[model samples]
Target chain A: MNDVIITAIQQTLIEGNVETAETAARAALEAGVDAQTILNEGLMRGADIVGQQFEAGEVFLPQLMFTARALKAAMAIITPELKRLSAESGISSSKGRVVLATIQSDIHDIGKNIVSTMLTTGGFEVIDLGVDVPIKRIISTALDEGADIIGCSAMLTTSMPFMSDLIKTLEAMGQRERFKVMIGGASVTPAYAERIGADGTAANAVQALQLARQFMQNALA
Target chain B: MDYLEIIDRSDSGEYISEENWDLEKVAMTCMRLVSQYDLKWDRQNLVPDDPALADRVFAAGLALAVEIGAYNRSSERILRFERDELESALRDMKQTLSMGQGADERVLFARQIEDSRPPLVWAGNPGAPHPEALFLPAVVSWAQEPIVDLITCGTLAEVDGREVRTGEALEITATRRELTYLHQALAHVGRPGMGMLAAQSSVSELGDLAAANPDYLRTCDAHLVPMLNELKIDNRNIARAVNSIEYGMRNGGLYCAISGGLGGDAPGCALISVASMILGLLTNRADYHILHPIHIRHVATSTREVLWVESVVLQAFARNAPAIIVTDVYPKSGALTRELLYETAANALAITVSGGHLEGCGSADGLVPHATGLEPRLMGEVGHAACRQGVTRAQANQWILQLMEKYEHVFRMPEGNPGARFDQAYDLETLQPLPEWTRMYEEVKTELKEMGLDLSG
Candidate 1:
């Protein structure tokens, strides 16, 4: 059982095939292996390999999409088992909800997809509103979904200013305190993030996950 | 393989070109010297500066002329019109133009190549003097006749934020004007020239430029596609041609191109990286030139490692691509001194002589189209000598080592102070150059001349 679970986890991580990873998780549960070990070893490890492949240029957008799909596949298979296990043990709780969108007037979604994949792995349920979403709609979604945080992605130099506008609009709406805004993209630098008054900034997908977690924790505290 | 079939067949993916001509016959019958002479052939017999190779190139051009028989369609590489043929074709095309004759295919073909020749650097608003324009006298002086290695007509924008004034016209009208400017500027430069194209400032979208100016797309041979139609053909905003497909031409303005330089290159990756980069260039040959645009300043390890690795990469890419490549070099800090200039020139020359085609001279990044002067000329000397100096790898290495030294100091300076742009950095006429500066250009030129660089010739 341990061997099957771990090998599936290993294959998921290394080969980036999420369905196999999911199958491994399901099989492990049936064989009485701990569900937590399956996910912690399988899904997270799968993500790390994808990130590495992305950085190494061994995987570009198309490959990244496949890995993300695989990760989702594995996660879908493991979710109920992991949840049942957590419910039985009484250790799991809702981590919080995050909303992600490529900011207004920019259509680039590739980077946004990478960040979303990582965030999902980090235990947040994300609602992606897609690209060219206007500021009012983003703020409204935050309010409507009772989201814990909002992540904005703008891939163009011309369009990134709207991220700041979103924040400013939140302030004008007098609900700035209700949301934690984090920005990511190729054109938006850390200095720019700071100048725009974003709560935090992310350079790549890995940083995005780390920043989201940190921002959520600090906001709660 | 009729490469044109590659474009013609839309749905038949992966079919051996339906035209069924053996690859060499099509390559030879057409004037794609880059394709015909490219690494597929025996490179041992060819050299760019070698009179024989250039002659072979000319012969290839003539063969294409013979194959086509008459100027009925635009040629790919063959500029076969003889003095008589050119006159007849030119007369007939002009007659067509005057009489509104039915589709001057010969003229259309000639115009296609002419249009493809690097958009003459359109120096927009040349009539108004830019403080930057002050250096033009020295630049033109240095560039006349044999010194004109290749010129892309330069343009300057009068921009107010995101909007350029040119954007005021109907998007399509402005585009036609922009295309007209390209054609007009090509005529203005007045020689069988090189293309350095311009964009119609920033408009809403690429299509708007055409939609606003339908006249820009007014060519009768093809209705679905008009304007520049090779593939991946692009006009650099400055000179940093972005992304591979953009290099290949995302819009209609493009003839296909392969991106050069490593946007995400890491150390020890040069040989493999450059080898792959060259492969991408050849996969599409009409527009993309297989040149390594090298830079050391950006991250992915250290500068020296980047430069050294890129040198090897450039040599390999140029050798394998068997095509013209432009090498990008960064200018270092400090005053514009001749020693520093030549040192950089020498380094560039070494790589280029190893068989790089065009050279992106001096601080070749976001700072492209930097008041063009000494850098390109100095770089050209080394590039010229590259073909002449070393046929063997080791000889080219030694020659580049000698050249790379003079310009290493350039990197040390505060960013943007390329020695060639000294006029902008400081008043060149008023602020006298340091003694070492005066001798540097002379010394390097003399040495390059000795190395068989024909700067004048």
Candidate 2:
């Protein structure tokens, strides 16, 4: 019965039926299915399929966005139960916490949003600070959230200096080693990333997810 | 509709969150229309020779414009438009635009598929960043090209060695200095009266407002009022139009629809491009429009998918609306390489044969200051040669496929083909191409000639 409910949740989420996904999550919880099992088997599995489809070019941004919405809906219903279980069992399920933002004065967010969705699907808890975010707010939010990675995006060359500034500011605050900094955007290059002292850069969202995973593994090491 | 009506409607229209507008109104609506029109993107034909497909794309685009309308980011409302209003705007849009004054004056008119007339070359390294020292020489490089009808410029990465931040007071200084350099460069080339699509330093309306003078950006020049991704606009762009209306500068509405973004693939992007153009006529009060469809991954128009999007969008506008459209040619490969020329030739052929004026050789995807006049020279050369030979869609597609084989591999590489910076490609003292760069250009020209693109004209 639990397997049937989990499959139904995955199907609804993959189909991007948000309300139905939320209903499935509630039903799973009512049927005494562990919140962690629903998240691992249903929500995460659905998101993984959507992400795989997006990477394969079989689906596009709208479908990815719709599935993300459905996942968000389902997560909202399951998060409280998961938190209760974590407190009782003393085991967290998240891969890692990440803070994402488009650097100051750059209003372009499509790329950043794509990375955010991909990261969320990868099981990282993402705190997405929307477009035109200042350096101070980003650092403060990362510190506050205990984030493992701080991802910045800049679509304009004018705003790209802020990414460098972010690194310099972190170094000045003696917090440079605290969080991993990864930058990507139309204007960002790997050379610029190295020049700015960023941990790494990615060409697209899939590479960004891989880079984030690599960063987390390094942190563990 | 006037700018006042646009503002009023922005504030008074039905409220919708930006996310909802993007997903539901823009994405969902485009998918429905794509299905309704049965618009399938033919990957093999980068430039389709089907008039029926063009008409269907136009109808779907018009329906999209009427259904989705423009979303106002500042007001968080939908700037609704009746079909009649959009149609009337399209009907009233200027079919011909007069730019510049005196000897360098040029009139840009609506072009048709297989247009016999040589498409005008608006050359420059548009929106690319340039150091202050290289800015003047970069503009002069293109201005000295005899085939270039008008010139555009990149943004100054620094002013007096200080970084220029957008929306800050320094932006005004940067914009004015950029124009001053542009004016100096044009006079240096004795094309002082040449029109320009400039003010790229203006990341916001402040710089645009500061540059509105006879000394800098003149009434004869044009500045961009860009639409955000998909079908969205903010007050900064509206303020640009409002400033240009009374100032009498030409407003170029820039719609850069992403290939794999909200509007799915090539066909969906083409439909969004058409709808964005129609809405831009009403909201941006644009005299002319720029079709710059960039790939979501590559961010370059020279990509196969982007070239297809540009081709179809240009054809749709040329066959149906007949508006003055300029297509941007941004190649992933930069200067001092044969790949840049091949990419330029491919883009020039596709755009020229599909009824659009050419505007760039924004090298290295316009990400870095890796552009020079040599590629734009090749762009003009290929464009004129294509017209002179009366290249067809089929022939152009074949040539484009050949050219893509030369440079499309760069898109897959981890570090893209950022060939060389301007300083490396040109002799700084004379602002002329070095032997190595010129040799590459000559070689590419010979190869393209062998492929039947006669550059003898």
Candidate 3:
């Protein structure tokens, strides 16, 4: 029965059929599978494969976006039950919480949105601060939310200096070690990120999710 | 009828949710219209050589304008235009834009497909980062070139020993300084009245507002009011357009549409590019349009796929609207290299033969400050040669294929080391390209002549 449910979820997400994915989630609940099990074995399993194909170039942006939409639909149907199960068992659903924003003076957010989508699907809770975000707002939110990581994006080369400024601000507050800093964008490179004192840098959304997971593991270690 | 009317309409239009405008309505509607029109691309000929196909793309682009309109990100609404309004704008749009005053003035007019006229050349460091000291030198480097008709400039990485933050007071000061340096550069070149494409230092509307004065950016100069990528706009751009129009300045639209993002692929991008051109007309009331379709991966338009889109879109506007279109040449490689020259030749050749004016070949994807005046001169040289030879679409396709074979392998490679800065590429004392850079340019021009371009005039 678990195998059937997993296959149903996988096929629905692969096809990007949102209604069918939602229906599959409901059916799995009716068939006596626990919500955590369903989330881990069914929804997450399907999303993980899609993310893999995307990174491998077997799937393109349009296909990955569609699959993400379908997975969101399935997660919507299963979220409440997962919350109930977590409340009863005293456990968490996500790996760690992250706060992401596009740095100030530039309003391009395609990369940020992609990273948020991939991170959320990879079992991390994400607080998206949208585009052209100021330095104080980003730092304060990360502290207030107890964020495990703060990722910033700047597509223009002019806005790239802001990432350096953000890292400096965190240091000035003496809260630098509390959260991992990740920077990525079209104009940003790994060398630039390291020079700016970023803990991690991702070239694309798939790599970003992997970097987030590594940050979480390091925190636990 | 004017920019104020458009601004008021953008603010007062029916409010829709951002979700519907960005995700659900825009892309889905564009996809549906693309399929319905049965538009397809020919990879061999980057610009569609067929007149009928060009007309079809134009019609489809107009249909898209009437359907999707332009989404206003600030207002959360779509600014719709009547068919009559669009038609009138097309019918009465300026054919020739007189840039600059008196002895330094140049006229930018429309070109038809295979038109034998020399396309206008506008050159400068287009938003590339420069050290405070190098900014003026870079402007002089581009303006001192005899072939360059207009000037744009790079921005200073720091002003007054501090970073120039956007939407801050420093932005206004930096922009004013940019124009001042430009005025000085023109005076140095003995063309004191040369027109400039203004506000290259402005990252927001505040910078533009500060520089809109007569001394900094004159009414005769062109102001670049850009549309956000993939059919979106904000209040900053709207304000720039409204202010420019009200001040009797000629506002032009500068749009860089992502190929793989909303446009889907090469063909979809071509359609979207056409739609973006029309959107510029309706929203900004632009005097001229600059179409830039960039690859999401390489962040340039030098690839054969992108060249084809540039060709077809130019033909669409040329054959249908009489709209003056200026195409951008964004190479993946940095300047002062053989690969950069080849990419520049291919991009310039395609634009010249397709009846589109060339804006620049500089700054290497706008990621580095590696551009000098030499590449833009080479661009003008090659462009003039193509126009004189009356190059056709078939001949251009063959030449470009040969050109791409030289550099497309490393098109996606990362720039491990930084590109050469302005000081390294040019001599600031003489405002001339370095000896090595000039040799490389001459060598590439000779190589082009050997490749049957015969640029030896």
Query: Which one is best on TM-score?
Result: 2
lDDT of 3 by residue, B306-352 (tens): 89888988998889998788888878777667788888899999999
CAPRI level of candidate 2: medium
lDDT of 2 by residue, B1-457 (tens): 7899999999999999877998989999999999999998777789999899888999999999999899988889899899999999999999899899999999999999999998999999778999999899988999999999999989997999998888778899999999999999999999999999998999988899999998988898899988888888888789999898889999999999988899998889989999999999978888999999988878888887888888888888888889899999999899887888999999999999999999998999897889999999999999999999999999999999998888889888777889988999999999999999999999999999999988998
Interface RMSD of each: 10.0, 1.2, 2.4
List the candidate numbers ranked by DockQ, top first. Answer: 2, 3, 1
My TM-score estimates for the predictions, one after another, are 0.53, 0.96, 0.94
Looking at model 3, the pairs that clash are B46-B308
TM-score of chain A of each: 0.83, 0.94, 0.90
Judged by lDDT, which candidate is best?
Answer: 2
User: Cα-based RMSD of the predictions, in order?
Assistant: 12.4, 2.0, 2.4
TM-score, cand. 2: 0.96
Q: Ten-residue segment with the worst summed lDDT in candidate 1 chain B?
A: B221-230
lDDT of 3 at B67: 79
- The reply for model 1, stretches above 4 Å from the true place, is A1-4, A49-66, A83-156, A184-187, B1-158, B161-195, B203-378, B390-457
Docking class of 1: incorrect
Residue B154 shift from truth in candidate 2, angstroms: 1.1
Q: DockQ for all models, in order? A: 0.10, 0.74, 0.44
